[model samples]
Target: MNGGVVTDERLQPDYEADDSSINNFEKSVSLKDLEGGAGQLPEQVHTHHGANGEATVYGDFEKDKEQDVEDLPTTTRVVTAQDWSSPDDPENPQNWSMLLRAYHTVPPALFGFTVTFGSSVYTPATHQITERFHVSSTAALLGLSLYVVGLAFGPVLAAPLSEIHGRNIVYKASLPIMMLFTLGAGFSQNFGSLLICRFFAGFFGSAVLAVGAGTNADLFPPRLRAIATSLFLLAPFAGPSLGPFVGGFAAQYKGWRWTQWCILFISIPVYLTCLPMRETYKKIILKRRAKRLGIAPPNGPAGLAAIKILAPYHFTISQVGLTFLAIGLGVAISTASAIITDRTLYQKRHRQALAEGRQHAAPEHRLYAAMMGSFGLPIGLFWFAWTADNGVHWAVPVIAAIPFAWGNLSLFISTALYLVDVYGSLNGASAVAANGILRYSFGAAFPLFTIQMYEKLGTGWATSLLGFISVLMLPIPWVLFRWGPQIRAESHYPTMIS
Candidate 1:
């Protein structure tokens, strides 16, 4: 039986019965009688006799009575549901006005920008930091590297918490904590204090990164999610790119301390942005509505269910591990000739399908940008290195950085969309959490060893090494594009949309 279609076997008349009383029973059983009341089953049963002196009975008396009850009309069930009162219910996030939706997106992006901007903003001040603390270059770099390490772990904890509480509350709680720690780092009296403070700032700041994608899913449907995702991704990539450029000037004139101060200053607006971000988690909203209406919740309080907690962790871990393998293999195999293209290309494909009357676009379509990005990454890295090696204009390598940044951004957004589309809003936060932890761990570790790699291998060879690795990873997006349907079909998790 299809979902929500109820069949009333108890009220269904049996033609084989010869008893005149059965006819009377059948007349009494109307559609209303079949659905007498919630959880009320028909007590009347019709009996039939066999010529061999055998008797058989029907009407919710079989061993599989529970299964039969499930097939009953939803109107006759004792289950509680928490859904929009009407299709146009204004409380449903999907029905929010365009202005309100835009309001929801920008604040998360700003929050992401301020936190990630701090990761690279202080790079230009590393020398000043070394001199002030009398520490080696490696030790001074820890200020930057450890912040990324904090980013990796922060989401692991925060995303899960968001699943329990709500996206708005997590933002309200985390932003201030991040701001305070950023201040601590700026005013630190010693090197140890600075590192400790920077790490804490990163940990708290990561809540936005951990949960922002999930927030987007809460607000937008699959069709519009692409644009929202592309915009949201800009912060993580653009902020890091712009930070060093801006910090270079600040480091030259205002000094190393100003870098931290600048981020803290910008944090003011980011914090204010959180004020209007209402609770967007569907379960929480439904629970609140249920309380107001004096009714039981549809699925009960979220995050307390065993499957909700465990399944998200399992799917998240699996996806992250697969991504890790792809990165490792790509690096180990070849990283060359990659270029970062606009992610809008994939969204364009989706819109095209919709225009052609296809309401459900293929999940693998999101991988289009990812495939292009895989190639772009190595090309940018190789270009930057070779240009730097030949002593070309400094601006040449700087311009070359664009492709690498673009490729990274495209890949991140594509994979993120894939996770959300496959796992849905409820579990998407956990998936993003796992991805952030692993990605940032690598982000953190790379800087720590980057200087050493360049010095020992020379810039050209070092960049070539990464280029070769990128070449190896080229197959990841390709394979997913080819086998995505089958892979998703095998998963225990449900896909929200194709």
Candidate 2:
């Protein structure tokens, strides 16, 4: 007797049946069942097949289904919010640790201090330079003016280049060029040679002033950027004030050429200090990181996604350009005011009095007073230029300038802070470009007709012309304050308020 696998009412053979007739009969029965007729197989047998054999056979199908679920793609998701509520997300540059931000900021500040110190140190050394080159005081002033011109224009090219190359590259390249020119400036034999070299040196040295601002934004977030910006701006402002003090002494003791050499000596240590400073611009840093990770660099949508995540508040180039223009215009107006009031008018009248040996010569303090009296550079220029021949005590113009330096510093500081606050990480490069363009163009153009104006119209009228220009520039700050929000809203760059 054959023993087959048993169900409740029928048996299924697990092995081949000994008789072929039984197998053929089973096939016929299955075909009849497919035609919708009931087979001879019992219900208990069907239940047994369904519970044991069919269930066991379908078990492998479930296992394959689970494997498919495991193979589905997964991704990291970002939640974009309109404000700065989170502190730990990588999106906020402010979220970076204090030590890291400091690392990015210190070098640029020192660089600015060094460069500006070098630039203006020549002011007190003008006499030494004149004696060395056998040129007049006006000609020596021209050399100083030429350097400022370089400072003005260098940033236009440097700022754009930094966008293409990393900041470190521009800094390293520009610094060395500045050094070479500063060093060469010492060896120049004639006035023209010195002027050309000084001009280029000013141009290259401007990198510190312009690029440093942008670098600070890269390191700090908007909430904390004001302090960083203040620190950066402090260098340039303080440098000019202090440079003449130090350069005066150095030029007095060591000679004018040594002023250039001393700066170069100081720069060596600063340059070496920059060795450990890492590049902070997110795009360049991440791109290099991707190469190291053996992943393909992000492209198209992926790249944009990463950039947007990293920099949620970035500004477009055009906005930055406009901001720079406004800043430049303001700076030019201020400078022209200074020239109109102080150099063209005050100095001219005061010197004339001394030359003629007037009965009651103006006290030297009048010069100081004129410098200190104005609301800013322009007011000081206005007071000094307008009052030069007024027959009042010379002390009046000098008293006026005291307010001028004060006001100028205040306005300049405020404007710088506003720009940094408005632009965030892009501040450094954008500021550099703006400063370079505005400072140079204005410095060059303002002084050109100034001498002629004073000579033709005399000090009082010449300064009044400048005072009127200052009044025009006065509306700039008010306009910015009122419409700044709308302007910032449209910017593609990151701003402090955003």
Candidate 3:
């Protein structure tokens, strides 16, 4: 062991470790203390992605030379970290052909599509649901709120499962269960049954939503990541944007029950893809190989809106659903620009970092176009709010939603990338989980009062109130961008090369 840390020099294969990428080895993970399965992880860690897209992981723990070894069965061996057999190992997800990597990426993204789709599709059916059950319109919205709240907390559980078992298992396990819940929702005879089914559907469906990106990271290395992620991110965005539009048509042509059926029917293909899916996590793959060899190694790894104000402008159920296309327009623009940004700005920074003799680029590079969203989120809200009048053209307020969505999409993507860069894979999900809870919980709780807020305060003030709240949170990204290093240095969380 070098510097009180374990090193797999014997396992280093053809790849050379970029010494610059290695951080303090003694302060990262304590392998002796970690278990065979999912190990306890520190709150934060610094990871430097090397030129080849592989990370050079370093951890601090003295070798347990005195531990018994001879007494173990021949089928068992001391477990240590495993490395790829070679730089070009076909088994490594990072080394998979670009087309193959993308195929893997798309399925999970589509699974995410099903999730957000289910979330918003229910919105257009609210009126029918309220009437059918003799419940207030406010009560019908619980379907949306509870589903989102599940989206929030479901990750708390699923992220760790992905760490322990790999993403495919979670995806495979959650989808059918989610579908079952959706079926229960479609067939529910009572309001309580519908609400219950919606919550459970969201809880199960969120498995893919939570860990799909981790699958992306497993497949794509740093250079191709942004572009791939942009495409992958499009699924969820497109789902929510298109959901109401489609649901509106479904509700019009069929009934509210058809909305639930639509989600299930569309998701069938995503479920089919999982039958051929391969595991992407390298650690889990190595663990499987070790199980065969008996080597004990440790290491584990929206919506809302459109309603009261748009009634006069796009009054028909189908028209209101058509209004959701405005959000789709915004998502499409952001996604296209995101692709361009990936090809140009992201690549430029990647190349520059390599040339400057640094293995990794600063996470702040992601925040450039994203900041306008922070300041402009409120602008978009107010623009749509004030302009949403009876005489004003419906298209005007609809156009306003474009910027709101642009800001929303850019900020979320940028922030997520920042988290992965800052915390790395090991702890990034936890960081994201902490934030997602508040995000989705409020998402759920807000709708409970949103209609009331809009009806009582008028659409202008109600929307403006959301804008105002967004303004209060505006300083968050800036603070992190400006003072991140200092904050990280001072924080209790430890840093690792991992």
Error of 2 at 218 (Å): 1.5
TM-score per prediction, in order, is 0.49, 0.47, 0.48
Put the candidates in TM-score order, highest first: 1, 3, 2
Backbone collisions counted per model: 18, 34, 2
RMSD of 3: 24.8
| Cα-based lDDT for every prediction | 0.63, 0.54, 0.65
**What would the per-residue lDDT of candidate 2 be over residues 162-188, giving only the tens digit for each residue?**
644567887778878888988888888
Model 1 agreement with the true structure over 1-498: per-residue lDDT tens digits: 112211244422232454554433332222223233324443445434333222232232222344654444322121123455456656779889989998999998888878878877776787899899997543565576457656755764566567667788999999899889889999988998898788778878988887787788888989998899778866775666667777778888999999998898889978997897798887777666545323445444233212222343333434433322332233212112111222245456758889999864676775666787777788888886688657465456555656665566456556655665566545553454455545644543343345457668877898889888988887898998888888778777776444
lDDT of 1 at 166: 75
How do the residues 424-497 of candidate 3 rate in per-residue lDDT, one tens digit apiece? 54555344444443453444334335545766888778888988888898887788667767777775665322
* Candidate topping lDDT: 3
Among these predictions, the greatest TM-score belongs to: 1
Model 3: which ten-residue window has the lowest total lDDT?
A: 71-80
Residue-level lDDT for 451 in candidate 1 = 44
